[model samples]
Target: MNRTNSSKSIRLLNYIEEKGNKLPHPVTIFILFTFIVIVLSHILYVMGTSVTFEGVNNETMETEMLTVEAVSLLVPEGIAYMFSNVVSNFTSFVALGPVLVAMLGVGVAEKSGYISALMTNTVTKAPKRFVTPIVVLMGVLSNVAASVGYVVLVPLGAIIFLGFNRHPLAGLSAAFAGVAGGYSANLVLGTNDPLLSGISTEAAKILDAGYVVNPTDNWFYMFASTFLIVILGTLITDKLIEPKLGKFVPTEPMGNQNNEVSAIEKKGLFWANISILLTILAIAILVVPENGPLRGEGGSIITSPFMSSIIFLMMVIFLIPGVVYGVVTKTVKNDKDIANLMTSSLETMAGFIVLIFFAAQFVALFNYTNLGTIIAVKGADLLQAIQLDGVLLLVALIIITTIINIFIAADSAKWAIMAPVFVPMFMQMGIAPEVTQVAYRIGDASTNIVSPLMPFFPLVVAFAQRYGKQNGVGTVISLMLPYSIMFLVCWTIFFVIWYLLGIPVGPGTNLNY
Candidate 1:
């Protein structure tokens, strides 16, 4: 009977693997779904079945369209209107701008052997047993530089582990888990924090007259999440991923077996560290005081000069350290070399540029069709009707968000679509928009490791293939399955405990009954 049950389980697992591998590319699926949704929305609009919600007497109310023409299909109108107003949707375009610039700098750093040197030094110095967790933690933290971790650290993890006669895939899994799964849980705020917060703020205003969810609204929670994810990720990598990788047999032999840290690289690291500290100290002097140059008129963190010019701060942080490293390591012999590095980084963004073009169009078309808004309103209404408790509502939201994430992987875009609906609905139910945003972030972030729709998912698979040729999307997904499932479980538990304890999701945001 036991043998039979084991066989049944193996068959079931095989079935799942086959099905998952056969799934369509996420981007292609999204484009198809967008077209279908547009058609359905137009059909419903023409039938005069489309509803719009507005506030009346402190209660939410819906109004139906009277004229079929109001909802009618007007291809020419959509084309002309959407085409002419492309500039209006430029905010979506801006989302990809920083990613491109950051990548350009990172690409140069990678090409010049900065990342390779850094990894070699780090792994050699750290305790052998602790290397996997450390690499994972570093990958998670590297999200501040956008796609840098995905491109640089993940592959390095495999190479470094293989050099140590350990399972390379195990190291790759650990890095991928941190880079993708722990995306939103960074120690410092990244582009995503402000972007998601803006959407949440806009969504909150749909129900409340004056509502603003700060970008750092989930700062405290996410700060804690950084450590939690590291610990959980470390444990899983060591216990689950490493063991599953089986006995270590070198698949790809390393050309440079000498793992010794060179004096030049050591000097570069020290100089880079010093430059980073100096930069932080300079920023501190500017923004730490009430009357400092970087402080705003109101002396608030949000309104402060520091917050206003965070991108510049990021640029300085990366540029200064990178420059120092380049100089000390003799990688930047001339100004042309620095320019070439920046140029190289931008060159790597070609794929991303192509992706953003289609993704931007899809998002614009989606918003123009009013389908996103309609779904949000209707979905919110249905959830409202259930009268589920806060904990249950959160769980439901997480599950829904996770499902949606599988199809729509762009974090900002998904939140932009969801915020208008979920934020207001939760607010009406006495749940804070901040809490809702945090929940959305957690749900959105957790499944990224396993989802093919995620932009970096294919990239990781390609990286894995370098060490394991037979490894494809299926191999990558299967490996990350443990991390994804474990993250969702542990992350949800954290949320439940935080909610039950009535902890603040962010500075002024509370998780309450």
Candidate 2:
């Protein structure tokens, strides 16, 4: 009976995967969406579609009646606007520059062996009983370097478990949970923070033109979530997954695989740590002093240069430690090596750049047509009429995002499409864009483990195959499903409690705008 149910579940997931892959590429979808929006704007304009709401005049600071009407792009003026703004739209995309700048520094750390060494040093040195939590914790932290966790820690987890004579699959599951499932939770800011926040900020401008969603808006919640994930992942592995997987017997000879940190690498890590402390100290000096340059008017830190320069500061934080580690280990011999590493990092962003081109056009046109505002106003009205405000509203967003995530796996792409509508709509219902953004992240991170369409899902399956020839994608999914479900359930509850308690999600951020 159990075998039959498992077979049915696998078949269903396989069907979903098959259909999802058949969908057009995200870039192509955006292009189609842009065309559709153009045609829809014309139709809606002819149909007299518009919405009236009270809005504040930014320049005059006065309350006034605002009517948003659909504007068609088929006219000569519309066509001219589209052609003239194409380059500017892509260049001015809020999510593009910060992510690219941050990635350059991340590339340095990842390429210079700093991130890998740090992950290895932490995981390999832990005691037997504590290794699982340490592995999970490293997985959660490894995301600050972006996608490095997927390639490095996922497989390293299996080796660690095998070394301890435990079920290697369990270790793989635990690590996979942390890397993919805990993706949104990190102790430090990464490329994703700026990317998602930028999108949310643009979305917020549909209603509040001057509103700015900081990259650190969700930092407080995500920082705490890191521990929640570590704890939940650790328990699921030891209590449920390891016991269910039973015992593993190696069929082949285990060869020597050096997983230990070398003496020189340790020395390099020491200097890297010192560099990080120095960086933090330098930043503190600029922000902590009453007359500091980074301090805002009246000694306010929130509205200061330090807050505005977070993206650049994040880059420097990673850049300095990476360079220090590289020089200490001779991995970076000179400025030329550093330049090459930065170039290598940017090369990985080629696909993202292409996607952003079409995405920018779609977002720019969507806003220009006033379709987003119209939709948001009407949608907010509907949600409020149905009493889906406050906690219920957030929970609904989480569930909706979770389902959509199975088909569309890119976080930025999904958020770009959803934010323009949901962020403004939620804001209308007295919810902050920051709260909406975090809810979307919970949904996005939860089902990543079970989503076959996720880019790394196939890679995880391949890793599992190393343990047993019979292991396949189903095995990996089944192993991780527990973690995914638990993360979704417990993480959502944690967020709800945080919201009810009226705790700020980040520095100076509130649940209500």
Candidate 3:
């Protein structure tokens, strides 16, 4: 029965990969997207296409009609902006800095042998039966640390599974699914939450001038989904993914020691934990009190320096532990060794650096020409005109967002353009801005693994190459597609049930205006 099931599953996945391989390279796709944007902008501009939505006055809190027009990329001013902003656009791109900075710290941990030792410790301590679920859970939680999981955990998952005489690809698929497929679900809020919320608030202003969507707007729902993803991810891996892979066969020699904790390594890990605790204590001192230096304006914790500096703090957190481990283990013979480790990590990002140049141009062009905005507004207008309301409308939005996510994977960029359309349109149906935001999150995150355009998709492919030298984009997508579909279906169901119960999506967040 297992072999028969595995054969059928393999055939289906093989078909998926074959179909996916027909698609262009991601870098080429983004480059082609720029041309499409340019042409579409010119055509729309000539047609004088525009949409009118209610806009709120920032000062007076009054609503008025705001006409959104598509500008021509071929226009003189547009040409000037495009040419002049090329360098700055790539340099200032949101994704470039976070991934690069985070990797530097991760590189130190990875290169100094800290990450390997930690992984060994974690695997040895964890019960074998709970490994899949725990890996999925960690992947879900990794959203809080930016791209750390994509760079670290996915590969780690494979190694962990291999140690237990299981097929490593199953572990890779599960981790990727939990990391990318469950990207929106996390116990602690991530950078994406603030970015999406800010856009939602801006869009909500069209309906209620003073309306605000906090970063924690979707916290309740997201927190719940974190567990849902772990469970679903685990079930899919153990039931479907693992069964299909059949057995473990190491294509590469395993270097990890099982349950063998060296005294030096144990001591290094202990002091690393101490450094982390001390840092946390110091941060708490600065942020916990009424007059804390990290507090926001009027003593707000959310908008404070501590919240704003999370990514930097993550880097610091990793750096301290990594350096401590390296020093104690003699992995870092000198300061130059630390520098070399960081550089080596950066070296692995060569393709990403190249890919970003194209992505930056495409994003900049899309923003300047306002094509994404027009499409979003048009979609919302159609739905509003049809009078699609309540649960049905929300479900439709999820499907629409999922389809769009295939070609566009930048969460913030998609939401920024989408919010101005969907938020106000949904508001017309008496749906709250926060609710619309949550629907978007469900769709956007669930489809990430299948999207070739997702930034980390290539990195995942590279990681897989270490295990199977010939594994390509198709293989990764095939392995991850089931999780993507399952997450979307299950998560959307949970969302609907939660909404029907009139549950608050977050603290003081509502489903209705």
The model with the greatest lDDT is 2
Please list the residue runs of candidate 3 whose C-alpha ends up more than 4 Å from where it truly belongs after superposition.
Answer: 1-13, 57-62, 141-180, 188-220, 236-261, 390-394, 400-441, 444-485, 498-513
Question: In angstroms, how far off is 168's CA in candidate 3?
Answer: 6.4
Which sequence of candidate numbers ranks them by TM-score, best first? 2, 1, 3
Better of 2 and 3 by lDDT: 2
Give the TM-scores of the predictions, in the order they appear. 0.79, 0.97, 0.76
lDDT of each: 0.71, 0.90, 0.78
Tens digits of per-residue lDDT, candidate 2, 401-476, equal 9999999898988998999899988887889999999999999999999998898898998988888777787788
Candidate 1 per-residue lDDT over residues 216-237, each given as its tens digit: 6788889899888989888988
Count of clashing pairs, candidate 3: 0
For candidate 3, write residues 1-513 as lDDT tens digits.
123323565566456545665667667777777898899999999999987766555567777766778899898998998889999978865556766776777678767877667755665567999999888887887676556778778888887787778888888888898889999999877656755776676566555658878767799999999999999999999998888778766577766625455999999988887888987888889999988998888988766787666566666777778888899999988899889988988898777678767766776677667565566567667777887668998898899999878766777656755666688777756789999999999999998988877878888888877777767766776677788888899999999999999999987677987
Looking at candidate 2, the ten consecutive residues that score lowest on lDDT are 1-10
User: What is the TM-score of candidate 1?
Assistant: 0.79
118 Cα displacement, candidate 1 (Å): 3.8
Q: Could you tell me which residue pairs clash in candidate 1? A: 104-345, 104-346
How many residue pairs clash per model? Answer: 2, 0, 0
